[model samples]
Target chain A: MAGIFKVKAKAKDGVTKVKMLAKHVMETGQRKDKKTGEIIPAKFIQEITVQHAGNTVFSGQLGTAMSKNPYFSFTFTGGAKGEELSISWTENTGASATETAKIK
Target chain B: MTMHRRTVVKAMLACGALVGLGAVIPGAAFAARNKDAFSSDDQAKAMQALFDAEPANSQDIVLKAPSIAENGAVVPVTVSTEMTGVESISIFVADNPTPLVAEFMIPAGTKASVATRIRMGKTSTITAVVKADGKLFSTARETKVTIGGCGG
Candidate 1:
């Protein structure tokens, strides 16, 4: 199955910039369907982590306040070109996914 | 017999308290511990739950957001700092039902900066708090929201 994240990273001037877009609905459990008039259950990313060479560069604890299809951008020092960065995330509902991308 | 995830999580929390900050552990316990912060509707409750201390306003950090966001559903925000030994950056929207938006951890050697989009319920003050070198520093800015995003 295709991963739920689109990750891109680039290295320049001894810094690696990483940008990611996660696929999620980010329901807050407050909205109600027009037909059913019932509250929608909340589902969102509870945590996300990015690792370079087994060291954490960025990790996030997210809530429903984040917009749908959350996007994040961050940078770290000393990533070489073509080096692989591992990214993973676990949702509030216990679902998770992992993906990797190479620094350009 | 397999150990329940929640049981292991409880153990992780204990380990964290046992070992100052529990930097040695390698699980998602940090996130699990802050689960209550996500659901907090009150700013003080969320702040205390997340940092265990009050944050002081500082000029060292930069918070970038629109003065007036036409669409509250997708407001872009960025937090950056020149301070060294930074640990984490957290965003909060005062008017949202859940004040805490997100918290990003910055490991050593990583730049103390992050960018993301968030939802806002109305015109509100958005605060960015940075924990660096064991000190909490923060900055706030007002974003006028014409269209609320909470879908409520």
Candidate 2:
């Protein structure tokens, strides 16, 4: 599924706050294909991790029960004014996507 | 004359026995009503593995969601807990194919708050699981999905 994710970050007193939204189908494998009448294999983002300056800040395990296009917001402890925050997700089927944001 | 009185007493005893059995064996009375969600053994096992314990009743957790969801594809849900020493927060949809919906890890010294949108296949109870200081606590609210937005 093609979708968009937005991340907004702000720095105050050396702390950086971040929020993210990602688009995905998150099929639970229980739903059947309309034409084939076969169950669709479960496909979802199994894991999501966020790192700031190579330090793991947040991570989560996701399941097929999540809605399409999940959105998450969180805060990290430290960041400079222009440092890069790396975000990535790995789907159960091996598909992965990553994005980077600069502290503002 | 005495035999008729004895027969009536025996019938009353039988009725009392049936009522007692129904009360003791929960399955006998509400098996049909239990079909709202979580019917399969495998699904139950999966839900169990995600959390240390089954969802329990709680008064401190507040779950916010629309009483009637217009869209099943995306139903917004917000959960907040007043319980102290919280470790994690999770959400589950009883009517979905997989009841274990989402889990959040709340690091120590952070506020225990989570808000998200979930997909509902139909009318179901939305559960919030809170793990506080190694013990599991939970609360639930019923949400009615008016339209079958999960590809009905």
Candidate 3:
């Protein structure tokens, strides 16, 4: 299955910048559907891990306070052009997905 | 079989504690939410629970956010620091329903910088705490929210 994340990486000045956008509703279990008026269950990315060359460079723990379709940007050292940067995320419902982006 | 039943109960309790501990262990892969900190209304208590050590004010840390947020639902926040050996970065909203917002772990090779959008229930001070070399440093800035996030 195609994961919900669109990621980009670019190498510059000994640092590789990574930007990611994930599609998610990020329901905090507080909002109600307009038609049904029923509470939406919390569904947000709980954890994210970013790896390059089999080593984790960055990881994050997130909560419901994040906005819908979260956007994350960070930079790390030691990445070269065409190198693979793998990103993975696990949601509150125990669903997880991983995708890789080549450094530009 | 009585002993077996007791052992099963004991094992279940142990598993529960492990799950709870996983959440608070910063670098653990199977991280669970810091429920107490994220659910806390008091900023001080949330900070204490999230980072056991108090963070000293630091000039090395750079926190960027809007002076006034047009929409509290998605306020852009970016934090960066030149501190070496940065282990993690955490963001907190002083007046949110749950003060603790997000925490990021920066392994050795990663730069001590991150950007994300956080929800604010109202106008409040936003704090970015950086952990480096087993010490905590922080910077805070006030951002006015015109409309409340987190469902107000």
TM-score of each: 0.86, 0.71, 0.84
User: Please, what are the lDDT tens digits per residue for candidate 3 over residues A32-102?
Assistant: 77789888788888889989999998899887788788888999888999899888888888889888888
> Share of real contacts kept by model 3?
0.74
Error of 3 at B27 (Å): 15
Interface RMSD of 1: 1.1
Q: What is every candidate's alpha-carbon RMSD to the true fold?
A: 9.2, 12.3, 7.1
A8-81 per-residue lDDT for model 1 (tens digits): 89999999999989888988888898788999899888789999999999999898899989999999998999
lDDT of 2 by residue, B42-74 (tens): 435545656535766788998898889988878
Q: Is candidate 2 or candidate 3 better by DockQ?
A: 3
Instruction: Tell me the spans in candidate 3 whose CA falls farther than 4 Å from its real position.
Output: B1-33
Residue B103 displacement in candidate 3 (angstroms): 0.3
CA lDDT of each prediction against the hidden true structure? 0.89, 0.72, 0.86
Off by over 4 Å in 2: A1-4, A12-17, A76-81, B1-47, B82-84
> What C-alpha lDDT, on a 0 to 100 scale, does residue A51 get in candidate 2?
75
The superposed Cα distance between candidate 3 and the true structure at residue B91, in angstroms, equals 0.2
Candidate 3 per-residue C-alpha lDDT over B1-152 given as tens digits, one digit per residue, 9 for 90 to 100: 99999999999999999977765564344335566666567778877877776899999999999999989899999999988989999999998877788899999888899999988889999999999999999999999999988772
Considering the two chains of model 3, state its CAPRI-style docking category. Answer: medium
- Reference-based lDDT, residue B8, model 3: 100
DockQ of each: 0.60, 0.21, 0.56
Interface quality of candidate 1 as DockQ: 0.60
